[model samples]
Target chain A: MTMYVVGHKIPDSDSICGAIALAYLKNQIDEPAIASRLGELSPETAFILDKFGFEAPEFKESYAGENVYIVDHSELTQAPDDIAQATIVGIVDHHKLGDLTTSTPLECWIRPVGCSNTIIKMMYDFHNVEIPKDIAGIMMCAILSDTVIFKSPTCTTADIKCVEALAEIAGIEDYKALGMEMFKVKSAVEGTPVRDLVMRDFKDFNMNGNKVGIGQLEVIDLAVFDDIKAELAADIAAMKNEGERHTMMLLLTDIMKEGSEVLVISEDDTLIERAYGKAPTDGKVWLDGVLSRKKQVVPPLQDAFA
Target chain B: MTMYVVGHKIPDSDSICGAIALAYLKNQIDEPAIASRLGELSPETAFILDKFGFEAPEFKESYAGENVYIVDHSELTQAPDDIAQATIVGIVDHHKLGDLTTSTPLECWIRPVGCSNTIIKMMYDFHNVEIPKDIAGIMMCAILSDTVIFKSPTCTTADIKCVEALAEIAGIEDYKALGMEMFKVKSAVEGTPVRDLVMRDFKDFNMNGNKVGIGQLEVIDLAVFDDIKAELAADIAAMKNEGERHTMMLLLTDIMKEGSEVLVISEDDTLIERAYGKAPTDGKVWLDGVLSRKKQVVPPLQDAFA
Candidate 1:
């Protein structure tokens, strides 16, 4: 059977590119695997794919009775609707271990690095498989995007080394310039719908039985969102009600400023205060030096929920 | 802070040996690490350690406030009492994914292979760290015990390759003979307390909120258990009540015969029937060609419970 490699819903650059690169590597060594996506790609990922001359993976949601390999995320909330029916053959992720259980032993290659692509790069070296140039290019871009050009706290030496090796294979001299270009494309939200912008990098978390939604919009400048901040807040409030979530938060992250301006809508706004020790004024607060959600945001929020 | 490496409770050969091997590997690369155990060693594991000229790992139950790297298993039911308070730094296991969540990105190397030692061998190869003679010996024995001398269904090509490499490093030309000798020591259950025998290789599972316990005793002959089967059942019944377990099962495996005589004590015995398509006769069932509890037993039972 052909195994389908996919990423979490609201596919980020790391998720989409990691799926493609991992599928390529799996085909080189072991099984016949194809890249797939659970949802539409973010503009950043789409731009990276086009820049690397690769097409978007086949969009798929239901994976019933299929052999699946997940990447980037392990939480069941981020998985496809019929993930319970699919045989999860393996997972390659760089996140906190979530409440996902399996009946059989699986191939898990989780690491503390910044991006799933870094671990996939390790897998390639482990199998002695040569990564194709385009795959390496996208994978390098994934690491850069995930690590925020090595500025995010989640970035590790492994991510940096993997990106350097991948850049060598990709024959890119100035990868940081490419990363800035990608983020520029990511920041082009002038005419994009608020729903699309929010859902671009959105994720749902099951925090102590409460559904919590978090979305990040990483841009070079936070001023891009000044005009539409209220609309974004109203949209997330509507999303909280529509998705029946206990809390919905949008992080307007200025990559240059190295912090997040968080807008939260919750049953009790004090949950955010309890998490970060900073009370929100008018449902907004500045979280200084909070770049990586997995590191800086979700853990404290999960602890507060616990 | 010093990190501790541990394995599942009622430590089997793979669990004990894997903890020692992984702690050694971690110390070679990263931090100061020590091997610890949640429970006493089984006779087979004791024999292997003695033959390898190694001491048993330090027995420490609670890992509160300690950084831990778990080996061989991932289930919270099999972990230490205060595992929730400990930081799970990583896991190297060969079991189904369990409901253990970490708050941070972790180093996980879980594989579908039969033995954790196989994955540890790969990890050593990944890091280019050479395994010591005694560690290789114990690791080889762990693979032999977990794979039932290559007879188990869970045994994979990776496991066979790992054992061969470890055997070469340990300078053991007749590892299979050593495996049989270890099994001989394992079969010496006579004069041992029934509770001790039952608890030698027992593990608890949270089967859909119900605590289910399973124990396995592999021997050369099933007749050794014939006189004590009723006593074993009574002790497991007492264990079920004391531990508030919904079900308890003991697999008296005849390794030479390649089968198991399962003695089950459950709230509803039909769960076994639903799992295996074979109803028990007087709370006992003879399952032919059932050597691996992880491969042929636990998965089906988990599914039935689900």
Candidate 2:
């Protein structure tokens, strides 16, 4: 048996769904392939899998034991397996390579498109595979999620083609309507804890010899901002007090506004002023039309740091 | 500004990433298009975006408030503001159709590939659009997810063509290695809760006048099953005691084995025996080379029920 272990780190629907579908495909070809997950799934992802009658992936943190194949997360540091035993025979990813090195000869497919799911979709298409309805739903979901329902700057033509084909199999139409329904379920604010509300999927970044923690909260109703701003302020202050090295930023993005209300909480008001060109008193800085953090916030912060 | 909301539902990387790419394409054609997320992202998805330094989607649950240019997940349930006010010009998806009524003439694109991300990639190829690296990463991720790293049954020829083109742009080779790495991550078990392990993404079905709750767990080390079996049994028993209407069934799928260990837990032992031809004593039932529930298990169960 040709035994191979495959997985994606910090798995989403695409990673999970792709792993499952590919494992199925490999088995069909009589290759012993296993699909694994590097992290826990979100509740929404769980809901999606349940709706489609699929299971969540098995969680594996690192590829330590057997032959390892990497997916979307390309950093070699994330996967520290014995490179000698683990000959990286293939790679399927949709991200710019950060720092990945393979000692063995491997087939690497890194496409600058929308999602790695698109590549998996294309592969299936090339092979003329007949996707089951449940797996088809997963492919459709992965495309919708990564492309922001075809709205992000990172999307590609291949992404659209894959979605069109998967849509036909999954029996879905009016992606906008389905997207709306799914988003409504996700953006619901009922019975959610305030801490959970403020600190979902937070990330830490270094800027100007200081580490900054950033958190994003998506809100369907802008009115929720009024109820949560003070609580969010306290949460930011607490994080700063808890020995966080640098400034803290919270982005409350109003989906309806198509913009974000940037809140920067820092001990050094000058640093906040330096980044945003306005000093914020009481540990608060609000900026309008600041949705793309990479394009808008990160660049300005990097410039200020420089 | 003429704004058109474009989106997909329960989206994966391809849907969201494709939306972004297509939105960019539309903008280049002088159409003001905004990409939106229909649901929350999974962890793997967040990792993909973070690696490429792209923003998470602006969450929009519905297109009821504005004019929508549909993408991956379009199904006509609720009408948007005005079909006349906004020309429903373009559509791109990969799922099966579900009642899309558009009176205005539109460019409809629904392909039978694995993902819409593939479509977007093909569009870039068709239009000779220069794919940015970030977009490439997103689209590749979408393909990997949707096609299960090229192992799904739902793939087509167009999907392959797009991925091949995208591979050149992203500077990657050996997709199989990458897919293996991703799947390996899914099999590692660390801090996952027992309840989560037992009940993760379970689904329900009707079989022989009985409600059957079927759950699947992917595992790399079969040795882990020895440790987890007792806990799984207890969890199953607890669920049975909860007065739910279903007989709970769990399948511990050994992806490498291309088989599963079926565990049937129910008050009705006769039903278990009737389904699998034997009552699983000591809480374990072994099945040889039974991996896919849809292909291998569901059919037998359906026949037994009939």
Candidate 3:
């Protein structure tokens, strides 16, 4: 009767918090489920867990459970290595179906919302399960992080509604200020190795048969990228040399300004111009009001590359 | 905006009723949507519609609309030709993802229920919309047809709950007798061309690069297959000559007996044996207690072919 509820590898705040919130709701209904993580915790997620006085969910590197319920992602590649052999009982995600299949029918809930946490909140409201204040806080933080405080294009009416209710339940009055605090923890670049900073928020993509990647970091001030652009470029070059991707773009997003500056290294230099409708000057360009990757960044890149 | 709501190309009772019932609910909620069909109606669906004092939804041969919402099925092969250019605003389905990608995030609700009508009923309940008797009758028929009157393995508690409520709304005190009436229309083979009878409920599948198909008919007796097995074998052989499928099967399902007799035609004879764990004598075999194609027939064939 034990079910392991987990999210994607290279865990973001939404994926991590979604697992926790969904497991809580499932357990309230007497479905024996435990929240777990697949990959390393991002700084913002770690910060949210610490503030809530909750330990991080156990890290399940390998899945050995009889029943597994995936949250926040449906990609088999992002799941446990032996997921193909395991019994997948359910999936709750907001991303594209990455060609995942089951030997039998299972419970699948995929919505087109800004964050998976929004769906989890709706599930809570649907079943009349009262969410705990700490769970509400983290869920709100995850929604705020994924939606960039409702400034991203992916935000919907459901997300905004859930955010308002969850913020009240979390005893938070100003969500914008909470969003700023989360970004402050995420965007702080303190003399860390350029390689570590680039890979922290990195995600790989397969664009028209070529491997590509984008790494984004949010900051209050946009000057963070200007400080170490050269060293970061060197690290990206080393990564490109590994043949993992043909293109690599590092995004330094200014959360306060609600915009992003993208630094690029690509053989197809015109791709960024075609995707954003502006040419990159000196291997860097500013995309106005481009704050979400799944909504704004990856889709256009996929189109241009295709 | 006029949104054309339609089902898959091979329209089943669930697909037809789901489109009609969903369109009714959406219009009540102030969304301008029309229930349309992609293919001709099956006899059982037409019977249900006629019994409910409703006309068959207008046939939509080609899509020329701005917004389209799909139900019952998710495959692009079952969608309109212009679906690639159209904006898919919402989807309420109960099947696997068919690799359809939209340019942006949109509303999607996919569950592993027995029928799409079950999900639509839940949506109605979620919105607190009362179901009309006509709509309830068709929805009940859809649930009964797809789940084989609650005898199929895909049936769940949620489905059973919906059926009970809908039966009361439809003024049916005895659903088993009503199911027999529907299946009497479905299984009526009086002088019907074997090709038409087989193709009436046929659905094609791609199993690991191999073309496969299944057709089912609900009858009161499994012995009826012995009369027309030769004609069915010839028509299916011609179907194979058309290069559509490597394996084609006709399931003579007895709703009362709760079993089926499969008349199969395959170039690979061992495949049928391996899929069902026994050889077919004279091109037919009685599969005791086998009712659901999605749950029983397709999965094993997918495994055998894969």
Candidate 4:
């Protein structure tokens, strides 16, 4: 049987690249596996795949009877529509433990690192399997994108070490330049649909039975979103109502400024105030030094909701 | 700060030895770690520890305000009462995924093997750390007991290979004889209280919001429980009512016969019937070739309850 290795919905660089890399490793070690994605890829992931001379994985949503190895994320909200019916053969994630359960034992390799690709790199080393050059290139880009070029608080020494080793393997002496190029593609907000912009890099969280939606748009400068802020807020409000979520947020992150200006559409603004200890002014809040949503944003909101 | 490594509430041989071996590996790799236990030792575990010239780990019931690494099992019912408050640093388990969530990233090493010690042995190989002789002895015994000396369906090639490697490290020429010795100690039930016998190797499961308790007693012959079957059933019934559990069961496994005679007490007897395709007569039924509660038992029961 061909086991499908997939990543979360609204696929990011780490989710797409980690699924491909993990599928490669699984094929070498255990079974015949195929790399798959749950949704359309972001521009950053597309650039990384093209730069590495690789194609995007096959898009597959429902995996009802197939064996699956999940990558990058484990939350049910981020998974496929029929994920409960699929047999989760393994998981390689760097996020907090999510509410996914299996009846049989599984191969779970979750580490407190910056990127899932970092853990996949460790797996390749453990099995003594050599990584192909193109795969290493894409994997290195994933680590860079997830860590925001080692500026995010989620970046760990392991991620840095893995990036260095992968760069050596891919023969890329200037990976930082490559990261900036990918982010440039990521930051192109012009001519993009407001719903697409909001859904790009978006994730839903189930906090104490209340659905919360969060999205991030990382750019070189926050000025890029100055004209589109109202449109983004209106789209977020529409999405919140459509999904019946208690709150919906869009983070306009300036990588150069090292902070985020958040747009909030919430049922009760106090939930946000209690989480960040800063009340939103006119449905917006400026969170200084907040670049990584997984590290800085989700945890406090989850705790406050609890 | 010392991180404590512990196992499930009713600490089996795998739980106790896995905590020790993993703590040893963590100390060599990362931080200060100590092996601890959630409850008292079983006869088989006691014999293995004594024969290996090792002491039982410190008993700790609550782990609030401490960092913890769980082994053997991950279900909240099997964890300490204050596990929700404790910061779970990591987990090394071989059972099905349980309902445990964490806000931070953790080091999770879960696999579909017979024993947690097998995965720990893999970890030791991955880190290139040498295991001490006595630790290897206890680890070998843990695999042997969990696999029923390689007679269990849960036993895999990885488990057999791990046991062979551990036996060579411990310098044990006849490991099967050692396994038999351990089982002999485990089979001793004369003059033991009924509640203690029922509680030995007990584990609780949350089956679709209904609490189900199950215990296993492995003996050389089925006749060992002939005189105590009635007493065991009564104790199980009392435990079920007191705990407000939907069902409680005890599996009297005969390793020599390669089958288990189950004593069941449940509010709905048809749940067992739907699971195993057998109706209980006098609250007892023979389950041929059912040696693993995790593999042959829990999944079907959980599905039926769902």
In CAPRI terms, where does candidate 2 land?
A: incorrect
Task: Write down the lDDT that model 2 would get.
Answer: 0.62
Q: Compared with the true structure, what per-residue lDDT tens digits does model 4 show for residues A1-306?
A: 899989899999998999899889888986899999989988889888888888899999889999998998778888888988988988999999898888888989999999999999999998889999999999999999999999999999999999999999999999899888878888899999999999999999999899999999999988888898989989999999999999999999999899999999898879888999999998899999999899899999988988
Enumerate the chain B TM-scores of all models: 0.98, 0.63, 0.94, 0.99
**Docking verdict class for candidate 4:** high
Q: lDDT (CA) for every model shown?
A: 0.92, 0.62, 0.83, 0.92
Runs in model 1 with CA error above 4 Å? Answer: none
Which scores better on DockQ, 3 or 4?
Answer: 4
> For model 1, how does the per-residue alpha-carbon lDDT over B197-273 read when each residue is reduced to its tens digit?
99888888888788999999999999999899999989988999999999999999999999999999899878999
The TM-scores of all predictions, comma-separated, are 0.98, 0.45, 0.94, 0.97
Docking class of 1: high
Residue range A65-122, candidate 3, lDDT tens digits: 4688888766555788888667788888787555566666676677888898998887
- Chain A TM-score from candidate 3: 0.93
Ranking by lDDT: 1, 4, 3, 2
Output per-candidate TM-scores for chain A, rounded to 2 decimals.
0.99, 0.76, 0.93, 0.98
Residue B230 alpha-carbon offset, candidate 1, angstroms: 2.2
Ranking by TM-score: 1, 4, 3, 2
Q: Between candidates 3 and 4, name the one with more favorable TM-score.
A: 4
lDDT of residue B271 for candidate 2: 64
- DockQ (C-alpha based) per candidate is 0.91, 0.01, 0.47, 0.88
